[model samples]
Target: MKRIIISGCNGKMGKKISSCIRERNDCTVVAGIDKNPESFDGFPVFAAPAECPVQADVLIDFSHPSALASLLAYCVDKKLPAVIATTGLSNEQIEQIKECSKQVPLFFSFNMSLGVNLLAQLAKKAAAVLGDQFDIEIIEKHHNQKIDAPSGTALMLADAVSSVLKEEPQYVYDRHAVRKKRSKNEIGIHAVRGGTIVGEHEILFAGHDEMLTLSHTAMSKEIFATGSINAAIFLCGKSAGLYDMGDIV
Candidate 1:
């Protein structure tokens, strides 16, 4: 059976993953790392990564960006494979993940749902076929508690669409101050935060006379929990490297 350690075990996503793993027979959580050291139902919870004592086959993190340093350090020190599901990471934190991946197998993704990744792939295909005639835009909605704007998934979709376009594309986050109209080479991204939105993303391809839209909606946190678990399982026994949803699919 695969052994797992959950970081942020007390958080919403962490608890959800723990519950999901309970229904499975192939793996079990050996320990947990959270800000609060209080004992969880089935596993011992440590205040920090360095304080954790149990050995596990994989580490799954759904914690804050602030936890990346210690989390990656612990993974490197133990040569443990990790599945990181945390979003809203800065570019520097991303670089840190890349650096750490050189020493340990790391699976990192902005969004873990299979549907979202599929949407990205479809968007790429659409961009390629539509070419310069289509003007692209992305809009994402999350809970009010969410701190970041535009969302990581929105950026991921934008990247996917732009990667296949013939001409270079520029990202336009906000237009409140910019008095000019939308540019031909611009990919506009917008964010909305409101009451308890699980997650919603829409990719709009506007052309001269028609529009094409691809969208994904996350109904609950369970889908992400399931995806992360799959990633953890896939990372087991793998060589040290950076992996994402593309690698899993």
Candidate 2:
């Protein structure tokens, strides 16, 4: 059995993961940490990482970005393996995560949907083969409550496309203020936020006389929660290093 500590226990995703883990006989949630004191399946909730009573084998974090630095510091101090599902981390924070990877296993990704990861790979391949023949664009939609525009997953897709193209694609978020012509080398990204959308992303490749599109839509949040648990299972007994979905999938 794998012992687990769930951070951000009060959030929607955290609670879902807690419930999912509790149903399993092969794994157990030993503790939950969150800013708000609340009950999760009759488990004690700690206000901070320092207050947890038992040492956990792994720490799974889906908390806010503001809390990531502190949580990572705690993980490194304890040398606890972690699976981070939180988004909105800056470039510098990402570098910090990479550094901490040397101390403990760390897994991070923009989206936990296995399909999305596959989509990223496909986009990269299409970009590489198509070369400069096609214009790529990424569009993503999520719940209005989500604070970040052009969700992290979209950027990951853009990065994949850019990396394979051998040229940087200018990311154009919005072009409403002034009239402008579409540049041949730009990869446009449009974000739509509205009414309880679980998550949706589409990647479009437009070429002369032809259009090809690849898309992934998350039907429910359970997919992400379930995927996270799967990642946790894969991380057990793994060596210390930075890892991603590709490592497990």
Query: In candidate 2, which residue pairs clash?
Result: none
Screening candidate 1 with a backbone cut-off below 3 angstroms (N, C-alpha, C), the clashing residue pairs are: none
RMSD of each: 0.8, 1.3
Per-residue lDDT tens digits for candidate 2, residues 1-249, read 988888998899999898889788878888888999687477788888877766878888988888888888888888889999988888888898899999999988888878889989998888898859888889999998999988999999999899987677788988785388888778999999999999999999999999889999998888888888888888878899998988765
Worst lDDT run of 10 residues, candidate 2, spans 169-178
Best by lDDT: 1
Work out the TM-score per prediction.
0.98, 0.96
Q: For this target, which candidate reaches the highest TM-score against the unseen true structure?
A: 1
Question: Lowest-scoring 10 consecutive residues by lDDT in candidate 1?
Answer: 34-43
TM-score, predicted candidate 2 vs. hidden true structure: 0.96
143: Cα error in model 2, Å: 0.9
